[model samples]
Target: MRKNPVFQNEVLGAAILQVRSGRARSRTTLAKALGVSPSTVGMYVDRLIAENFLSESGVRQGPMGRPRRLLTTLAGAGWFAGVEFHALRVQAVGVDFSGRQTTAVVRPLPAEVTADSVIKTILLCVAKLTEAMQGPLLAVGLGVPGLVDPQAGIGLHYAFIPDWNQVPVSSLISTRLGVPVILQNNLRAIALAERWFGMGHDLNDYVILGPRSGFGIAMVLHGKLVEGAHHAAGEVGRWPWPLGGGDGTSQELHHVLSAPATWRRLAGVSVREKLPEDLRAALVEFAATDSAEWQAVCADFARVIGCLQLLTDTEVFILHGPLTALGERFCESIIRAARALAPALATAPLKVVPSVLGDDAGALGAASLAMEAWSPA
Candidate 1:
């Protein structure tokens, strides 16, 4: 792809992602990464400077020739928005050029939501958010649960939200808002948030799991995201299981472990809002208690982590979603269970941590996707 003629915007935007990732501080380094000469980088960077996307930070003495001028993004020069809809709720978060969130909104969804309703709610959320934007809105990222074809910007299918099938979410949003858009699975968005803004930023090998709402994973290996065939890499939650049979067949793990579904069943009550920490803590204890159903859930969770450990030597595993509300002790409990049943990999040195972003991870992650769509690396 690099050998082909790259569009000026794509080439420049990719450079911006590199800069934001702290991969290059000077055009010389960016040019090296871009496989172009320093003069060519200067030519394009000057244009970026004119656009207020890049600015001269200072100078760095080059190994040869004159000192190299450092470049940086101007904070708050622009804004991006990310909207995540999952567990029958819609959340939107807006971030400035520096990636700090400036505004956010969350709305509960009705029991029976259709495509049109999802559309209306999303538009309303975006409208409310942009009203507070201090800079131009560059793009929006829409996050949904289940299979997504990012290149096509479509939600291919959703087990929980069947009516959402084949929705061209990106096109609709872009047409309505007059800006670019990116559509992705909510879990992948969470992973990107970790990569760019959260705990996994510095790690090359890590796994992110959200078992509560649904089971999904986003893995970064050697500093690159692992998106399997057709961007459906993280749909492990949908894999069929035969409960302890290990005879090697199972059905959607999400039907039982997803937080909203599981909570309703175990608590014997419906929750209209996010579960309180105390109630969440109680649910944790209940699930950890000695019962076939609860024990099986923990065992299955461990088996899943064990599968990941066996499949790849990921160094860190971060659990997002309701599992986070379970607290660190429970998070570590999941890790311990996995390690106990783990295959004999020479060294599994893995640690499980709770998501620091809390309820905001999804929205912020969506916003991170918007930023990436403009400047993918």
Candidate 2:
């Protein structure tokens, strides 16, 4: 048996993307763009064509040579599914080979946050969306909360669920669905989603801020997602708030900035406001308010953003997850505060905006990851 040449080869995948994105139409140009020899690129291009992932459509007349054949992607070659699941909900989306989403589904998680229940919900969502798919489901990308070892396809730990540690989640899902499955941290998945289809589409450096039940971030620097040596590049939840010069009373940024924190603080202050037990509803209440507590929350959150700007110096900060419900005004406040604190280091402007994909980003990002991780063959 022979292994597939196109499988897991960055150069082969790059060749397909170069042609699909219209960045390179000829083997010569693709070789130049990828910084590889023309013959090397030609080999991959030919293999891609044979695999139905690429097709030569026409020719380009060169100024000093014979006509070069032009290549284009075959959008119907295959499709992918992405799933994002946490303790509360499950979301799934389907996209074609060209990265166009065809269908999506969202469902509340079963009361029990067991691994079995979560995987079952994911399969159901995929099945529901599969009915609307335009091609074969080639792979799946899963966005999971907490620590994930994507290369190993394992869910390392998720504090919210019991017995989620070291679960072979990707393999279990793939075995049930009969397709290759990949895992990504949910927050990181949101960043990838932004890169492919949302706010960070045009920028190479940015951060995805998750201020929902926790305070974490996903950093994309120099056109690549940064997962530290331990795969915890953006796990800032445990970091003490205020970065520096904080009194001994300072708390973890996660507890200070999370929606549950806000609700807990409010509940302690007064009974006039009815705080909802549901986290989503609580977030909505938090978003609609401008009380002293909310203002304090904004100011503290702004300081973190300010510190992030000074440290990372990324072009944009995209707010994802439940915090996005705070709307454009909340982002504007963060932007103003961050700029005031960081000041201008360069001529480029700083941007803090809400995610374009909103709650759907995690799932769609999972799908984008699947698409990015695998090339049609």
Candidate 3:
């Protein structure tokens, strides 16, 4: 069978509009942007409209003469599901055509969430959320907190969710739910969310780093997620550091910079205050420059950032998860230490920003995956 070049062009044109500003462009405008004839652009728009990928919203009155019909992508034509599996909980959200979330649910599990239990909980959540959907779901996106084989939809290793070795998450869920599914690393999902709608909307290169269940990193280069050959590109937690041995198999930094780890190292200190309050207190106490424990944690964070700088050469590094939840002060301390370790890089002003998406990144990324699947054809 032969492929339709016009249809393919239409899909590309629609995707460009969908991702750029979510606004519809006229045939003349599209032609000018795509360097094609107005007639060709009209044909593409007509096909996309016929496929229900786009619709004529109304007419725009130009200065020249008659009003021209404006076409918009139909965001409500279908829906997709996104899920994020974390150590303590599984967060799921449903997104419709316009990239608006329809439903969101979070299910907490034991510290050790078994494979069977995780699947069962996810199915239950899907059932609860999709009860009102008018038709079959389009696709599903799952984010796991470790290495993943995206092509096979399998989780190679989830350090936080032990016993998830080589689990074919996509096939298992697709079999039960009867829909296409995609599996990705949690950190990669975070980077995707940022790239699609968050701080990374304009930037072409950046990195997201922090301690979740364990430390993780995700990079966006040239406006695309840089998943390596085996889909384990940004696994920077294993990088060797001065505080840890060079074997590169230890979770030394995870244990030193994590929320619970930081609190444990502080002995009697409590992080019960709100994020802002906690940050203020930590900043004042650390400013005294006498807390050996605080200094050690900062050093560990700096080591991670230094390695990330040398590796990805990303200008913007976003910090989040339990560590940043402790407060802005903690994040500031890490940034300060990171600057000290790499003086030259700091002098050029490496932006170590906090995560803008927070806990919602996973669900949003999942939605984005679904959107990509259901995009115009």
Model 2 lDDT per residue over 1-377, tens place:
12455543777777766675567888888999988887767777888888888888777898888998887777788888989988888989888887788888999986767988888889999999888886788899999988888889999888889979899998899899999999999989988888778867668899989877777899999989888887778888878865784689877888767666656664455434554656555566566666777667777777877777878989888887666766788887766665555556233366788877867889889988897788544
In order, the Cα lDDT scores of the candidates are: 0.77, 0.80, 0.71
Winner by lDDT: 2
User: Candidate 3 has which clashing residue pairs, if any?
Assistant: 75-97, 75-98
Q: Tell me the tens digit of each residue's lDDT in model 1 across 1-377.
A: 23444576688887887777777789878998888888888877887788788888777887789997787877667899999997478999988886778999888777887777887888899999989988788889887788888888898887667588899988888899998899888887888889878998778888888775677898878977787887788777777764454555555777656766556555655546455544456567564444555455566677777788778778888888775665676666666777677656335676778878777787888899988877522
List candidate 2 segments past 4 Å from native: 1-9, 25-28, 58-70, 242-250, 260-291, 339-349
- The lowest-lDDT stretch of 10 consecutive residues in candidate 1 is 287-296
**lDDT of the structure predicted as candidate 3:** 0.71
**Count of backbone collisions within predicted model 3:** 2
TM-score of 3: 0.82
**Once superposed on the true structure, which residue ranges of model 1 sit more than 4 Å away at CA?**
1-5, 58-69, 243-251, 261-297, 343-346, 375-377
Clashes of 1: 7
> Candidate 2: lDDT of 310?
76
